[model samples]
Target: MKKSLLTLGAILSLAVISCKKSESGNKSVIKTDSTATIVTDTDGKIDSVSQSSSTVDVNGKKYEKTDFVYKATDGTLVKVVFKNDPKESTVAITSNKKTFTLPKAETKGDETIYKKDDMTARVKGDSLHLEQGDNIIELKRTKI
Candidate 1:
């Protein structure tokens, strides 16, 4: 009886450990699709406009970005100068040398800044991030 009880206890412990390992092996999946729009006035009227999403996996790497309008403290859309990729480049796992900054405005306003080196903001996984600079705002897909 003592031997049998010991064997049962060992088996139970193994099962518990296996379950934990499997759970950790699994990855969390997040899906998003949404829209962000911002309109700013020149002068000291509006100083900033900005928006971004949470960490998401794109083309296998983790990535996230502010929404259409990332406002600065000065009430300016400094980060959102460029709405979309004019080059119409494809969104893939590979990195592109292209970089963009907020469009220069005549008014005294803030600019939108993109942190490209942030690893948590990188795109990952079999999933792909499309252009339009539109991050997953809502859980929907664009007509590709």
Candidate 2:
């Protein structure tokens, strides 16, 4: 009786292992849509541009984040890094060699606005409209 049970267990184990191998054979490697491009701002702050959107280490914990690269009207690149916390969201806008971290001010329907001091950013779909002092910057998201 014991010999029969041992044989049955070995067969079951082999069947499970073979099933796993078959299931894994058709799996493909998925790539991240986001890419990282480290840039230094005027304030000397380094933004690593998070490696991936779904996997970003924030304060030692994983959080959902996305980094966007936009093409300005003059062809300059505007990097916007978004990090979300449990309570609020933050947007770090680096443009024209300057950078500012703006907190969530309010959400107006489809547009979410961020503000800090004299800087303001309004995000609507693929457009990023930013205002600083007397200068207004308009950008559309582009592929990096």
The stretch of ten residues in a row with the least summed lDDT in candidate 2 is: 47-56
Let me know the TM-score candidate 2 reaches against the reference structure: 0.57
TM-score of 1: 0.20
TM-score of each: 0.20, 0.57
- What is each predicted model's overall lDDT from 0 to 1? 0.34, 0.79
Local lDDT at 85 for model 1: 37
Model 2 accuracy (lDDT, Cα): 0.79
Query: Candidate 1: lDDT over CA atoms?
Result: 0.34
lDDT by residue for model 1 over 1-144, one digit each (tens)?
Answer: 999999999999999888744554436766466665443445535324333334556566655443332222333222221232332212212213443432312222242222323211212211112234444321111111
